[model samples]
Target: MSNDVAILGVGMHKWGKWGKNFVEYGVKACLDALKDAGIEWTDVDFVSGADTVRNGYPGYVAGATFAQALGWTGARVASSYAACASGATGMNAARAQILAGMADVALVIGADTTPKGFLAPTSGDRPDDPDWLRFRLLGAANPTYFGLYARRRMELYGATEKDFAKVKVKNAAHGFKNSYARYNKKFTEEEVLNSPMVSDPLRLFEICATSDGAAAVVLTSMDFARKHTANPIKIAAISTVTPTYPNTVIEMPNFATDSSAVVGLPDAPFRDSIAKAAYEEAGLGPEDLDLAEVYDLSSALELDWYENIGLCKEGEAERLLNDGETTMGGRVPVNPSGGLACFGEAVPAQAISQVCELTWQLRGAAGERQVKGAKVGLTVNQGLFGHGSSVIVTK
Candidate 1:
């Protein structure tokens, strides 16, 4: 009767602009996950894939595409697309199947081959599409929103550009030894501060870049997992909650916040609610987390996650970063895999990649970036629109 699903294996292709087809990257990661799980492609009864919008037709039907690429093993296939939360969506699908007795074993995969420069909206003059309207009218690219948040934090919480720089500095060092990280170079606060500003208060080093990468995981029912391994990292909860009405905070691809004129605010903010639901489902809390991997789209955003994920209270994230509580060997290391700061954004693959890092950490195999005695980890990321992605994993 447990809601937990066992994570038998996790894998990722090195993050970079390899320029090869996304399918190749996905296939490699899938194969690696299968090998790690000690299972065969034919052994999987379900395939759940996160869709990549940038890729063509095959990307749309990623589940079937990967199934075909892996030789059509008669596995049931499903694909999910929720912008940055795509991987979590696919993961939710796989977990549902396993928990519902539809399948004993499932494979979840995501990959992306990104385009250069700012991630713009898809072509055409569609006014109805808020994403397109944002680009066409206000030119409010992703960084623009990032900048707005940074500036707001600076104003309300006294967070300086230096505090933001320290986030990049810390994450850079964490990722320095990470082989899967795209930017494995250590960075100094000076270097971060000196870097050109992409968004006000956000330097080039602070903002994550677009990259090509893939990540995958093998999941099974607890009964199936017990047959294979004595101990397995269990996915305790997966939260893909949608934003409540009157989502006051402005989200990405949208120009304005929801008007609170008629409806009252929800009891909790959207971002805070994301992890809250997962925590409730897992019977855990922020205090129970040994470590966390949060979406760091911008260096300043990492601090925001500290509060949103309950690492600290609002306006206290800068204090946590400055106090070293969120660093390696600290109370609760955040982004031990270097986060998006080191890996950049691979869209559909990002959330799954976060789970992969947690899987390694829980197994005590994360090498230099490992958090000592790490038993439980959480990942929180938000995709465009109101997609909320957060997963709780425990050893």
Candidate 2:
């Protein structure tokens, strides 16, 4: 694939309950991205949207809805749905179009108004639906899966709840500077440890909150970017990969592991595979990354990402955390944008928001929270039900 896509601009609607419709949030973010790119909405040749589950039938055709809301410029429109990975997938589509010469400039948008309480499966008890089955049979809220992973890490690597708390502490400090973060308040280790338990070994503070937010990006061909700005941060790779079978790594909302009963799972877990694909495509390794923005739905998940992204060896993530290696001003920092631990889960908007943070860091515009002298950045996230996303950005 051509590494010729450049991010001209990125924007986000301030996260939190604004009591507005998803379309309004999306339009605001879209317009902000256009303004940031110094381009007009009419100048975009195509638009891609990350689909959100609507209260009614209106959610399915997100691209058309967003386009119409923006005055129907009749730009080539596409909508993508990949659960939490929807935003990254939307970005992947926009970049592909730019690389294929299908469109010189494209708009990528994702926004969501999430439901309260546990993120329930779609209504109706369809036995065939794994999401429903997991909920019904296992009573596994998302936190249960997070608990399983955290427990596994404890068993395999001896990572303590304190290590996980460090993640929350670090990210919360960073989030304190992020105006868009839903939870701007910092948490102490004692506070994190004392928070109400959502699942075994994971407390409410340890888990990311469901948030309402929107994010958008303006992508263009490298040629177009060069004409518009001298130093546009370019997207080196976008990995929208899936898992291999016998995926023994137990994922969310699944009652049983991929039957090692049939075939042995690959040595690398599916999560690592996502980052590997992006690293391979970018012709760079994790060592080359100046910073990373990963999905930290739970604090334990952040530790897992440190190893999965090859920033550290297996079970060594805690050591890295203790060494302050993953914090800002440390070697090859991870989640300098505060991650979902601080930002919370905006679902469709989260992955795009990761890139938005990377763009700011690469442009040397991230005040205070910036990773000093960052040249290459990576964003990694896994969507439930087998969707994976990883993107590499370089100055």
Candidate 3:
């Protein structure tokens, strides 16, 4: 498909446990994006915001709250929440508005201060919330699910604990150069293996921590973009896909996977399904990609995406890592901006931040972490359950 929308600007508040209000981060990121675009808040035709549930009332109506903060000009407003997919969902909302002629320019925002330790349900009571039930009843913390994936890899693919630790080591090395990363310290493979285990099979470094951060982007119609500057990176496709019925694999906040007793399992897992949609929409295969930024909640999960995103054949993910094919000098570098290993899991902010990294890399502006001559990049953010977002961009 042809590109219709241009990412004129991208910005973010550094990811860390700053112990501050979510609004502060959002406002900071918005201002930076607006500045980068050379477009004032008053000039924006619309503003889209991602919900940060921990903030109570403000989160429920994030679009207006952010609008008011930036001196409201009656820009069209939209809000969305989908576990970790909030940022990309907001981007999609903004992009759709522009493509539909509802607006010429839009600012997409996703900001949050993640809770300490495990993220619990927003409401105090109510078994209706799957997050609450998973914590209260099953004691299935997020790490437990990460453990399951890791153990499964060990059993099926012969992936060892050292392989998992290698992911932490690689990401930490990448994080050391990223100023926005929450943890900039380089991790040694030995340190990762020696660190205390969180959930069995997954060590401390193997899991991402929670952090406070915000990221925003200015997306505009291609016509408006040409008037502003030359050589703009365009958003080629945005894929938000859910699993087909009978999703057999276990996911976060869910007690159990869907039963295949009645219906046989689908050919592809939800993660691969998400990437497949993106590739189809962009009219490009995994071989065409210059790089990818994936949700690496765990080391094993990072490897899973190597196969899930079709960078390699199923079960051949180990070869990619072993051959240094996923590194900066590799055929398709993954997570050159450090990713969650350094950025942490800021539910709302992370998805947009991944795109920000993509924008910089595509523009040849990502200084130390630059993917040489990068022309195409994709960001894959999978939320709890079936909510998944994948964005494909090109220069």
Candidate 4:
């Protein structure tokens, strides 16, 4: 397919615990995007929404939900559900539709009203579903899985609690600069280290919270974009991949992992494979990237992504962080928009917001947090159940 689909506009509703309808958040963000694109609702040929499961039946019919909220211009509609990667999955749907000549322009949206604490399993009696069984039997929340990874890093990679604390400090600094961020207060290493521990190795400050937020983007074919604006940012590549067999990594809400002693592990791990696909499609590598926004579920997870996304050698992530490279103005800055640490896991809306940050940075409109001369940006996030996403955007 062509690599010239352009993002005409990006918008978001302020992320927080707003006790309002998800429709309100979604429509506001959509209208903001439409206004930014200088297009009317009637101009949109199609629309797509990232499905939310936390809400009631309306969550399931996300596309129709948003369309009805936005006054229904008889636009073709679609929806997708991919856990935390849901928004990116929806974005891929819109991009694919535009590339196929099915629509000249598309509006993509995602929003969620996060529950108080860890998200619980929605299944009633599905014993086979790992998510349901793990929580039911062990009461092991998502943070427990993050703790496991953090501990593993300490043992295997000589990472320290200080290393993890450093991440909270860095992300908070950037978050403080973003007006759309939910938690704008800056954090310190002492504060993060002294914070209560939710799990064995991970602390409260190092982990992200659940949030309510919404984001939307307007996309169009390269030809259509040319007539609208001269400096159109292109969606260069979108990678939505799944894991290979005998996946040895222990993911969230799962009892165990695949046995790899006999069958052996895949050539590339799940996270690595996700980013490799994007790089191959974009014909670029870490060296070419100006910045990246990754799924920083925990501070340690950000370090893991630094390696997974090829920012540095496998064992060099901690050094990368200690040397001040992952901060806002560093070489190949990561999470310049504060990431999940600032905005928390809004899930469906999170990935869409990542692209929004990239759009702003590329446009040189990210005041205070802008990475100077940013030309290419990448966003990497994964949902449970083998959903992986990596989208590359370029000016």
Candidate that would win on TM-score: 1
In TM-score terms, candidate 2 sits at 0.98
Instruction: Compare the candidates by lDDT and give the number of the best one.
Output: 1
Q: All models: lDDT?
A: 0.94, 0.88, 0.89, 0.91
Clash pairs, candidate 4, are: none
* Pairs clashing within candidate 1: none
Q: Write the per-residue lDDT of candidate 1 for residues 32-96, one digit (tens) a residue.
A: 99999999989999999999999999999899889999998788999999999999999999999
Q: Which ten residues in a row have the lowest lDDT in candidate 4?
A: 1-10
lDDT of 2 at 269: 79
State which candidate, 3 or 4, has the greater lDDT.
4
| Cα lDDT tens digits for candidate 2, 241-333 | 998887777887677777776576676779999999999999999989899998999999999999999999998999999999888889978
User: Which stretches in model 1 have alpha-carbon errors above 4 Å?
Assistant: none
**Residue 297 of model 1, lDDT score:** 98
Indicate the TM-score of model 3.
0.98
Report per-prediction Cα RMSD to one decimal. 0.8, 1.2, 1.1, 1.1
